[model samples]
Target: MSLFGDDELPPVTARESQLDFWNQVAFERVQAQFKSGSMHHALLLLGPGGIGRETFAQELAQWVLCQNHSQLDSACGSCKSCQLFVAETHPDYHLLAVEDEKTQISVNQVRVLIESMQESAHQSGWKLANISDVAALNQNSYNALLKTLEEPQPQTLLILQAEQLQQVPATIRSRSQLVALSVNEQATIEAWLAERKGGMTEELKLALSLFPQAPYKAEDFANNGDAVKCGDFILDISCLMQGNESPLALAEKWLPDIEDCCLWMLLMMRDLLLLQQANDKSCISLQGQTEALTNIVNILNNQRLMQLNEKIVELRSLLIKKSPVNLSSSWQALLIYCSQLAQKTAKSA
Candidate 1:
């Protein structure tokens, strides 16, 4: 089930970052597809953010271009073709992604990829093109890419990485061999992380509760020690929510995990909803998170909580817009709004 190579193919011992169980499952499925001669010309990998679909897709490409394409389940990592793949010099293999943060994968990139596929492969076998973050494509780019899918090159494989599958056009979806990537279960992810020698600190647990399926992301926090900063930020957040300090002033000092802070707030909001729904206090899922959510929930009633959650959602939408707002100011505004609302809740309660 190792995504990097086949079961018979030797395991990749040189890997630094680890792939989770679900990623291995995806690898196994891709291997099966190749072995059965049922591999589609186009594959669409859909999944939640932070799931290892990009890594899975890259490994799947290597498998497809293996020189000794015998069993079909895996790539012979030692083969000449595989070497080229590893070196990223494989003439037949192409990857297209956003050119930069400001620009998307333009129609020109798609055009070049499609044109390259029309030519013969360096290994004279299969051709692979991985277009990552397919949803990042503009309307013109998607339409341009659609033509290539309708008339795919022989012995060619196209992989699309879709984080927001809903945003992709239906035409692209219908043509692709749809593969859904899911987060590994909590136990599975924890075991995977433990094997990778992660410290498994409380911050990691907190991130897992928020991100849930992406252990690598949890490991990221583990490596950087951002959890401690988050802990401090949460304390300041609690103070701001309680009107003991200015929200804007607190935002200036709490900068390590700005994104994590947003995610924590969202997760805490969900926990508050759970608290509201539960008949018994012990039924709350936020057991370890009690200290974090207590002040967050105390500041807002159910309706105010809903509105605050909506603001978080709106912030995410604004982030996706071509023009992003000043993130720090945005964060400060959110904190101030929540703090003011918290005061109202205290008065009402």
Candidate 2:
């Protein structure tokens, strides 16, 4: 869903940068709790990725650390603390995430962060740590953080964020206050995109259609010409089905975008599988290629299609976990399976 507001929003401000429209309710509740001096030391802001949970955390942190709540719980943006936060030089604030090219947080990182939060704040106010994608914490990382979680420092703030909340252990969940965020409306998100991307174009529609309820992702898709690439992808799948495309070359060409390649393949196979069972477009994500996919679905070996779908799921999971597996050969084999999907039926005939 869209995070930024349209015409209804006031002029730009430091607070505006962090306060996404969909996050207002959660923000207000936290703000009220803070004002009442009953806010918890540790908080788990739970929501799907691209739904503005990160921004919500930032806004909350800025509010808590702001020496002057010059605008009703929003940061003043002029005080020393606000200035330091904006500069990313605040001695009292820390932002933690999975290190670059690495998928999970390390025990050492967790230990260091906990130690920093345990110290006296240089500003003598609040010491804060915002852990993005906290689900990336491994068992050892979690163990390192448990002591601090149980005995949270006074006037300290620890904000944990995760898209897949199930990945978080129940022990951690029980310690922190959880806030689950939801979007305003799909139409509102679309309107915000239209205003920013210059009217509701076909690319915009296709992007949003591809990534439902993930407006930022949709915007990224539109910006990156994935829409055209998707059309190309559909054509390549049809060509492969017709024995006009080589699986080896296709895999090589798609290796750079293997994750999306696998994802699109899965979604397309899903559409094919659905059409095999019933002629339904409502559940189709790649709506633009419905007719093409429907035509392609008619000749393939249905059982092989199901197996290919399953294989894609398995590979996709490996990619999501950043597993150290040989996917190059897997990709080639998967595409070979797809390329020959229609062959079995033809031979049987």
Backbone clashes for every candidate come to: 1, 1
Candidate 2 structure, TM-score to reference = 0.82
Per-residue lDDT tens digits for candidate 1, residues 61-175, read: 8767776656435565677677888898989999998876646888888889888999887784899899888867888888888888999888999999886656567999999
RMSD to the true structure for each prediction, in A, is 6.0, 7.2
Report how far off residue 186 is in candidate 1 (Å). 2.4
Model 2 lDDT per residue over 182-287, tens place:
7758899899999999898878887776566567878888888898898788878788877888989988988888988876787688788888777787777677
Which residue pairs collide in model 2, if any? 1-213
In candidate 1, stretches whose alpha carbon ends up further than 4 angstroms from where it belongs are 1-20, 48-50, 100-103, 198-200, 247-258, 275-292, 317-333, 346-349
Give the 10-residue window scoring lowest on summed lDDT in candidate 2.
Answer: 4-13
lDDT of each: 0.74, 0.81
Per-residue lDDT value at 158 in model 2: 93
Candidate 2 stretches with Cα past 4 Å from truth are 1-17, 69-71, 100-104, 169-171, 273-291, 301-307
Candidate 1 collision pairs: 299-342
Cα shift from native, residue 345, model 1 (Å): 2.8
